[model samples]
Target: MSLTNKAERSLISHEEYEIVRLTHHPDIYDVAGEDLQATRKRLRDLQEKERTLAREKRRISRGKAEPRGGSFPGTQERPSQRKQVFAAAVKRLSREIDRRARIAARAPQAEIAERALAMRRENFNASHAAADTANEGMQVIASRRRRTTVHPGKVGRVSQRTKAAQARRDAKG
Candidate 1:
């Protein structure tokens, strides 16, 4: 009979019967009718056989020996350090902007106001430039799956209202 047909004919599968048969077999018996040494030897032999099989499997998987040297140098900085530097720079710039805005609000004269606006624009540009550098650095550290958003300062379009107001103010001046 075929192996499959023989297995089907048995009370249980061939594999299951083998396991049951092995479990019931006594390897050695002492004067007290207890098998200690035989059981230990059998268990040890089974464990050694399993280890040998595992080693063979690993050797088969790694067909060729791995190389010992030739590691590439990493260029990217840590995310936390980059974030800390960016945050500190942004905070300092924000405080400067608030201080200038307050001074402009309190001061009188169109010339002073224009100067303040110019200073504000310069400050904004400088901060954005730093932020752009940080963002580029972040691209190297950030996950490949993440998407980047453009900063408002980097956007080139001027609003219609802003353009119209600038025109009116220029005409008045």
Candidate 2:
């Protein structure tokens, strides 16, 4: 994620936390549910789960970001503890993104082909057969429809007389 995205996400999370916090107010909880502490804990737990999932996704998607290598990455000294914490968090996210970008920049080769082959050998084999069967059913349905529907013979020349002739033939049948 971009720095802006991280900042925006944090702000939004703050807003959401506030909303959850407000829900615990005595007036609201009288109708909503009276377990203020439990509700807060539940919201906190959900937020933690979300963070954990995002962390895992970042790990999986690692090596996509363009790394800023002008100065030494980890050597940037932090004066304050809070700055150090934020810097570390940002560094981790940047590393994941940058790591992939570097690898992709090197040019694709046998590795990509191997991965594709591995995927081809996996769970989609059944689905491929299923798709063919579905298409066959659709084709038969389409053929049946074409045989039954009345179509203009000479390309948009369905005159009133022509329609009447077909209608009379239908009435007889």
Candidate 3:
């Protein structure tokens, strides 16, 4: 038999530190023996835990609580109530589609195309509304500035100069 140093022998025998260079089998304990009773107990315990966890998750997801009135988060309306909301939305959409189709059929081709373009832009209607409000606010501020200014003539001259400079920069580009 070959003799091994204390360090090498300890490493080879260690449960956690596997000697891959010595053997193809990484785990020496598995090659040595297995506790069937312990494995069966562990598997049964895991299965029981999984079943309990699944049941608890389902209960939580289903929202085990008293139903209170009117649209609240995590509370679903009944089928009839949902059908009413769906019907209203569908009716509104159909009305809009019919209105647009009528306009397209009656109007000139160019006018119809323009209307369609405008409707497509209206899809981001909220953003356009915000921009319009901002522009109106700026115009109000500008009018107030003009009213307060001591020299209205100088203000107009300065504005003309600024516009000419901007125009020159834009033309160069």
Q: Please tell me which predicted candidate would have the highest lDDT against the true structure.
A: 2
Q: Model 2 segments beyond 4 Å from truth? A: 1-34, 63-173
- lDDT by residue (1-173, candidate 3, tens digit) is 22233432342224211222122223222432133233333433433544444454456568974344445323131323222322332343344445556776777987879987886565544333233464343211122344554676676897899999999999999
Q: Which ten residues in a row have the lowest lDDT in candidate 1?
A: 27-36
Q: What are the TM-scores, per candidate, against the unseen true structure?
A: 0.20, 0.22, 0.20
Task: Encode model 1's per-residue lDDT on 1-173: one tens digit a residue.
Answer: 11232332242334433322333215111112123334334434444544544454455459744433355223112323322322332343344445556777776677788987887675655533243354343212222586879897756556766898899999998
In candidate 1, stretches whose alpha carbon ends up further than 4 angstroms from where it belongs are 1-75, 109-173
1-173 in candidate 2: lDDT tens per residue?
Answer: 33343343343445443434344225332522234445445545544544544454455459655434455423122213223223333343344445555776666766788887776565345344333454344211122344555565755565767999999999999
Better of 1 and 2 by TM-score: 2
The number of the candidate with the highest TM-score is 2
* Candidate scoring better on TM-score of 2 and 3: 2
lDDT values of the candidates? 0.42, 0.45, 0.42
- Residue 50, candidate 3: Cα error in Å is 32
Assess candidate 3 and give its TM-score to the true structure: 0.20
